[model samples]
Target: MKQSTDLPGLIPVFPLPGALLLPRSRLPLHIFEPRYLAMLEDCLKTPHRLIGMVQPNAVPGRDESGLHKIGCAGRVTQFSETEDGRYMITLSGISRFRVQSEVDGFTAYRRCEVSWDGFDQDRAPISDTDCAFDRKVFMRLLDRYFASQDLSADWQTLEDAEDELLINSLSMLLDFSPEDKQALLEAPSLGTRRETLVTLIEYAMRGGEGDVMQ
Candidate 1:
């Protein structure tokens, strides 16, 4: 897939805590809410079918105060509309972005002015040689973490997957706290993300208290 040269200055955002999208990864979303359904309809008419995936700072009920500054921009790669006016869509991550400012919009869903200056590297393919990731230690820690959580994965498939996919997929799929997931999303490099993931797993194994995904 070719990288998008013309990333938009303004983007529609979906702020769901603990839901993560990393560059070159894919996230599947179910759009049923009226505002989001409208957002999707509007996005589908545009040339750039992009949506920003961000995490809310506070839980949905407590406050509607704010969202984290960093997020990943994804393009709608696959979409299906239901007879009941719902959408099941898959977004393929394009790049990571920083929220420069919020742009007030007429739509019920929020919009933001984003800057991708620092995350240009996200536009390129990340290879195993790109960073010093300790795969051996990561796997060991992951094994222990999985056992403790009573989670099972297909080891053969995971081991065969590409480095970037393995790291980002695990980061998105794991049941980490919103803060931890945001931390993973904001990690500057693949190596840094791998290390942070290992640390989180270790902390969980040590009985550290944190909120699980609701």
Candidate 2:
């Protein structure tokens, strides 16, 4: 599929180092920083509360620091405003973005121009064998992974997940290193992404770093 170039109606972004947003996934964020608070205000006045999610190459600290070349743009699907004037928003991933430029960051938040490229939104297929393996092997390992991390999950809903939901949700939930998340974002196809998630799950279950299977 042909990738999308920067369109006229692009949104500003606050780059959060080390986090990645993959297509079809949902990211829940608590907006507390001042610049991001203003960014949310700007988005509220617009038709779509859209923003790009990017990472910084170095650890994020202080003003005007490290940021990476790529990120994803997401639309705010839901928002709840706190009495203290913060926003708790859930963003639904729409497209992948390449960081074009970053604005000055003297203010509380930073902004950037981004372009979407190389992400396909149409439903991609997963083989029955792959899907079954994804369910059985991946879930077993995922349960082990959660236990190792001392976290608990609602397995009932997770067990009923559709293939796409299963893949995307698991990808988002894993405490993968930044590089692993970036690789998942750059995966060629949905099946490939699913396979990557399964590989990560199994590796984490075995207490290993991400391996070549992804």
Candidate 3:
């Protein structure tokens, strides 16, 4: 697949807590709200069907209260419209971006001016050989974490996945809190992310009482 690094200055954003989209990963979304439905329509008409997946600040209030500074840009790779005017879409992760400013837009959905310079590496693939990640340790921690959460998965698939895919997929699928997900999304490198994931798993196993996962 071609990497999507040519991001626009302003892009529509979906602020969902505890949801994550990482470079080279895929995020499946169901657009039921009217504003998000409209966002989906507008994205389909564009040459680059892109959307920014961000996390809303933990503060309580309206949905648009606040958002984290960092997020991942994803391309709408699969889409379907339901008779009820809802949309089901799958986004293929492109790159990570930092919000520079929030743009005033007429659309009910929000838009942000973003910068992708710091995450330029997200556009390129990193070989597992370049990192000193202990997959066995990660998997062992994951096993205990899953048991505590009462979740199960195909172990074989996870064992065979590439390092990047394995780490990112776990980051997205795990039932971590919003803050934990954001930390994974903001980790500086794949190796760092792997370390973060292991730490998060251990924390969860200890019943959420430990040092910060970062």
Candidate 4:
């Protein structure tokens, strides 16, 4: 299902610097800013209220600067309103998009024309190079990683996941640098992405943080 470049149901987007949303993965977000809270409200009003999540290098006057060109569109699948009126929303990524141009809108949320190049509306096929043996090794290391970090995870459910989920979750757990995440986002195929993620994890585990993200 290739999304039309001219898809008519474009929604408001919120750009989050340094976060990457992969397909079939869920990103939890806290929406507290007034502008973003309004965006969440508007999204709730629509059936498919989607927003683009991107990272900015710095915030500018506040220290977090401008945004990166690439981002992923996520739909607000689950949301709740807190006592203080803050919003807790779960963003489920739909697809990747390259920013084409920003649109001037009255709302605080930014709007942009996007091009779906790396991600069409479908998952790229897994390649032969992504062998089962390597995947097993990655899982073993992943278990060690979880244990080392004292993270609670469902191992049974994890064991049932396909290669793609395993790789995506691994990527998130490694907390790869933004640049490295971008590289994974731009990977041409699933096998290649998996391999790159594995390499990144191995490198990070070897005390190579500086080189990992760059």
Candidate 5:
């Protein structure tokens, strides 16, 4: 088990809008960009194998920092390279960090110094049983949300998923805007994320357009 202190303070960041990687969740990524490919190669050489997944700030004309303040660090768990040199990898979320500042370096991709305070719980995986999720009610809400979006999901798989897994995966896979997804990623806890998830669904069902009310 990696201790919190073992977490790296500096990590290469992948600033992809609309992408959310919460602690204990898995995100599959296709790495085709030259910078990200270099980042991936560098990560494989490091012992931590961590990559920070952050979103571009949502506000228009706000390019002060370009990225949101918070992001989740993911450990590269699965990786493979294709014949065309593209890399396929899966990142397992480790913890959420607040960006301290961008690090200027020779690397092509962005790197940041991140502070991992107040996210100690992320270091330890929560047992699926600890999640106080009411699957039945949430499933009904999800059904309506999915139907309204004209999207289909494998019912059996969703039924079999662990509580945290279901919630986090939905948060990442849903077609919500980058801003909405960032909200889900920044949620303080599993239960809170679940609440935020439900609220977003209800808002969408009601035809609430951009910038969902918090």
Candidate 6:
């Protein structure tokens, strides 16, 4: 966990599509590639242990359009090494940042200068009372969507999740494309993200291809 004032101006970035990490959520990643494994080794030497998880932008004409402009930074929270030399780690989402510029570096992975502007609300505390939703309606739609993808969830657990947790978890777990996932990631707030999620689910049901809305 990093203090707001202590957030780094630059951090190593992991450019993977369909891997979204929202603030306060956890994303587990398998580090096997030589570059990312090296990235983990370097990150472990730093106290903050922060990594920027950004998705490659499929859209064109943006400066350095290889990656999205916005992404969330996460702190290494759990880690273990396998006998096969693979590293498994979990990242706890810290904050969202805008890419100011990509740093030219000798390291195997990419790094970026980021600005933590307009996302101060990510660090705010979330309470159970803040997580209200129309589950009856959502669950019904989810049931149909899940069946189409041959998936299922512990409805009881989902029903018990905090509003932020529910939305963020589903956003990360759903099998939407990079474009759809980016929409959820760039949502201005929780309420707006929820609306986007519902709209995506509705879109998927209407023939947009995607897996379960996990």
Q: Tell me how candidate 3 scores on lDDT.
A: 0.85
Best prediction by TM-score: 5
The lDDT leader among the candidates is: 5
Estimate candidate 5's alpha-carbon lDDT, on a 0 to 1 scale: 0.88
Q: Please, what are the lDDT tens digits per residue for candidate 1 over residues 1-214?
A: 2344578889999998889999889999999999999889899888989999998886488767688899999999999988998899999999989998889869999999998877867887654233687677778888888999999999998888888889999999988888899999988988888878877888889888874322
Expressed as tens digits, the lDDT of each residue in 132-162 for candidate 5 is 7889999999999889989999999999998
Q: List the residue pairs that clash in candidate 6.
A: none
Candidate 3 lDDT, 1-214, residue by residue in tens:
2333456878999998888999889999999998998898898899878899998875556654788999998999998988987888899998889998888869999999998887767887653222688888778878888888899889999999988889889989987788889999999988888878887887777787533654
Candidate 3 TM-score, C-alpha based: 0.90
Please provide TM-scores, in order, for all candidate models, with all chains considered together: 0.90, 0.78, 0.90, 0.81, 0.93, 0.90
Residue 96 in candidate 5 has what lDDT?
A: 89
- 45-146, model 2: which lDDT tens digit per residue? 877577788765665465456666667777789999899989999887767767777666554566776656444452123321233454676678778878
> CA lDDT of 39 in candidate 3?
90
After TM-score superposition, the amount by which residue 131's alpha carbon in candidate 3 deviates from its true location, in angstroms, is 1.9
CA lDDT of each candidate? 0.86, 0.70, 0.85, 0.70, 0.88, 0.86
Better of 1 and 6 by TM-score: 1
**Candidate 6 lDDT, 1-214, residue by residue in tens:** 3346779898999999899999999999999999999999999899899999999865556545488899999999999999999999999998999999999989989999999878878866652223446767877888898887789799899889878888899999988888788888998888788888998888887886664333
Error of 3 at 157 (Å): 0.4
C-alpha lDDT (0 to 100) for residue 60 of candidate 5: 67
Query: What's the lDDT for residue 54 in model 6?
Result: 97
